[model samples]
Target chain A: MLNFDSQGLMPAVIVDDETGTVLLVAFMNQEAYQLTRESGQTHFFSRSRNRIWHKGEQSGNVQDVRDMFVNCEENSLLIRVKQHGDAACHEGYQSCYYRRLLPDESYEIVAERIFDPEDVYGTE
Target chain B: MLNFDSQGLMPAVIVDDETGTVLLVAFMNQEAYQLTRESGQTHFFSRSRNRIWHKGEQSGNVQDVRDMFVNCEENSLLIRVKQHGDAACHEGYQSCYYRRLLPDESYEIVAERIFDPEDVYGTE
Candidate 1:
């Protein structure tokens, strides 16, 4: 029942299966979704790069698919996954959600970086 | 630093502030983002409706935003909110993600419906 928008993509929410933390939000095209369904791992469409990327393909911090859910309208997808390696974020944080916005319109760093992106991507 | 895509929108991940359960995924436009920041409540641009909506405005199941987070690329938003009523899904489930996908390629109902959608939307 899932439907893509005019851009041929839908939003996917990645959550930590054990901790319930929202790891990140990504997008998926039909191809990415099909591969993810078949492989039981996260795959995404990069909006900027205009290509499909297997999660952690370069950094090796993969997200192991645990379960998937779709909204009642089938407009969005939610996937609970076990994060492999130290982080799910390229910035080396366990989650892409590291900064918390305050009421004063400023931000506070709420999470610690688990790996250094420079260390992971530089050598790649 | 948030940037909308070519469609002038970005993905918003809605999560339970305390439980961290992903409740739903929505889209936000510039106007919606501004109103959300001003009101501390969830506002979304309905792509299908072609307008802005204050969540729970119709069903009385509002989402009181607790915090906001932006990704490293500032392309997506993570919103942690407290749901006011029993449901966030129009289907009357506490979470839009009530069905879990099994390896067999079938869906299993994993969460209980907290309210009846017909009741809430009726007599409106």
Candidate 2:
């Protein structure tokens, strides 16, 4: 049996197949996980929204599944995918990680925005 | 304002600083984040138990904070750390990622067990 957490959720790591940089993290339930494997697309179960949502449903930044990895306990998953848009982050960055925390205990912006959030999400 | 999800949690990605390999994924609350930064260690908020937990408290495989990264929207965090001990996975592996999914839909074990989980967690 696949080990789902007490919440019936398993965390998924979305990463760029070529670059190996993580795009973001999301959660999946059994249904979402099965659908993802069958459809070869990325899908997440929104605990807050109480629904399964496609990755590119809003921003057209879909992730085409390349491969998957699981932890030994089968409780966590790593998804390697071919990212389809100029950005994966809702904030218009290629990767969600755009800022780095410095050794001085401050933060630094490390990545450039690949797309304009206002243009994609349309002013919100 | 930091975007805590509707569930009042933010997802965190843990990565090995030297190797750049993602170790695992966890979640944090504002309090957990503050403690992590202040203590230079990894802390997580367990949604299931509704408690704050130190990563290495039990396994002694603690993560020493090296740096941190925040996504553009401040919704997600990437933790760079120096992992202590031989393994970070409760399954006695170096990382939580140990199995790779093949194109044929079968899973392959890609990582070796660095330590004996039976010796640590005790025979289940």
Candidate 3:
């Protein structure tokens, strides 16, 4: 079981510890945090839209929480989970942090893309 | 080109505007801010490890920044990018957020997993 502050909100990131893969980052409100605590699942609060949005609610790319850790400060947290989608990224890729930066101050795309957006989300 | 506040650090999230794909979330320092402004690339400051990390420096999954937006409060920012990997999430899935919460307060995995952890990062 994980302990959460009474503040009712914590910054969290889902990471693949073995490969150092960062799945996604979001905040958890009291309900979301408690929900995640009761169940080994990942939940997040959408700061942009200001709503309680569960990952893969519509896409079926759910995160099964395996473990969780709070930072030394306890202000933020990290969760390790099992992903159920070919691409956790909404854009049809595995990781959201796919792009790399160059020493020259530029950046480039490096990861293999999976799932055609047209097929997954349907064409506009 | 993007302008930076004197504070030298800005919160940012890269998203695919079309599909509502949240590519990644990270902060930007002044140097990283300038770098992204000069070049259409995504850069972030790692608050955890406390360092400057680009999206796909090692994995080659780079983010090509297409657009940038600031919140109404201007405290946080958003970047629209083209991800180059099968999964932008480090856990070998597309998104780091891959879980859904049920009405019963439990959660479940819903997405399709892409790469096998054993193959992607080797066994424990």
Candidate 4:
């Protein structure tokens, strides 16, 4: 069995299968892990929402799992997937990692927005 | 400022700069984050040890940071680095994620071992 932290969650790193681009990092509870394995789609445990998150449930940006790997410690997971939508980040970037940290500790926008968040999410 | 979790730690995904291979996923406390930023090397907070960890401190497998990116949520970080040694995993694989999950829920060794853990860690 895979190890879960004290919180019963394990961090999962999602990557683009072909491009090797890191898409998102999220946590997965046992239920989420089992669901992903059964459905071949990425599901995560949202820490804030305290529920199982079906990726793209809100944005239609679901990730189709291509492959999965478990770290040696069994405390984390690496998932390669085919991202269904142009954006994986809720902020509209292709990747969640869109801000490059500079030498001076400032951040620069390094990725172009693939979609307009306002158009998709309809303004919080 | 980057958002740390309630435990004052943030997850960081380390990647190979040239290959874009996901090398490791670790955590960083504020001190470890500052040390990594100052030294241009990967420093992590060892949850097991409850202290700041300098990657390669004992194994001599240091990762030289090439670039860093903060996720849109400002909670996680992606670090691209030049890996110094043949392996990043204590178990002697280039990556910690060396075991691929088979469809039947079994694991397969997908990556070749780069070193012997017993030789390096003196058989813990």
User: Number of the top candidate by lDDT?
Assistant: 4
Interface RMSD of 1: 1.2
Which segments of candidate 4 are over 4 A away from where they belong? none
Model 2: per-residue Cα lDDT over A14-87, one tens digit each? 98998889888888999998889889999999876899989989988999999889876677889989999857
Better of 1 and 2 by lDDT: 1
**For candidate 3, lDDT tens digit of each residue in A3-95?**
343435566767654444565556798788877777667778775677777887867888888766443234555576788775667767676
Best model number under TM-score: 4
Considering summed lDDT, which 10 consecutive residues are worst modelled in model 3 chain A?
A1-10
A35: Cα error in model 3, Å: 2.0
Rank candidates by TM-score, best first: 4, 1, 2, 3
TM-score of chain B of 3: 0.76
Q: Tens digit of lDDT per residue, candidate 1, span A1-124?
A: 6788888898899988888888889999999999998888999999889999999999877888988898887768899898998588898888887887677767788898888788889955
Query: What is the Å distance of residue A75 in model 3 from its true position?
Result: 0.7
- What digit string (tens of lDDT, one per residue) describes model 3 on residues B1-124? 2334344555576666455555445669887877776766777777666787777675566778776544323445556777776566555655544454444534455556766656655676
Q: What is each predicted model's overall lDDT from 0 to 1?
A: 0.87, 0.85, 0.63, 0.93
Q: Name the best candidate (by DockQ).
A: 4
DockQ of each candidate, alpha-carbon based: 0.79, 0.63, 0.05, 0.90
Decreasing DockQ order of the candidates:
4, 1, 2, 3
Q: Who is ahead in TM-score, 1 or 2?
A: 1
What residue runs in model 2 are displaced by over 4 Å at the alpha carbon?
Answer: A5-7, A47-50, A101-107, B47-51, B101-106, B121-124
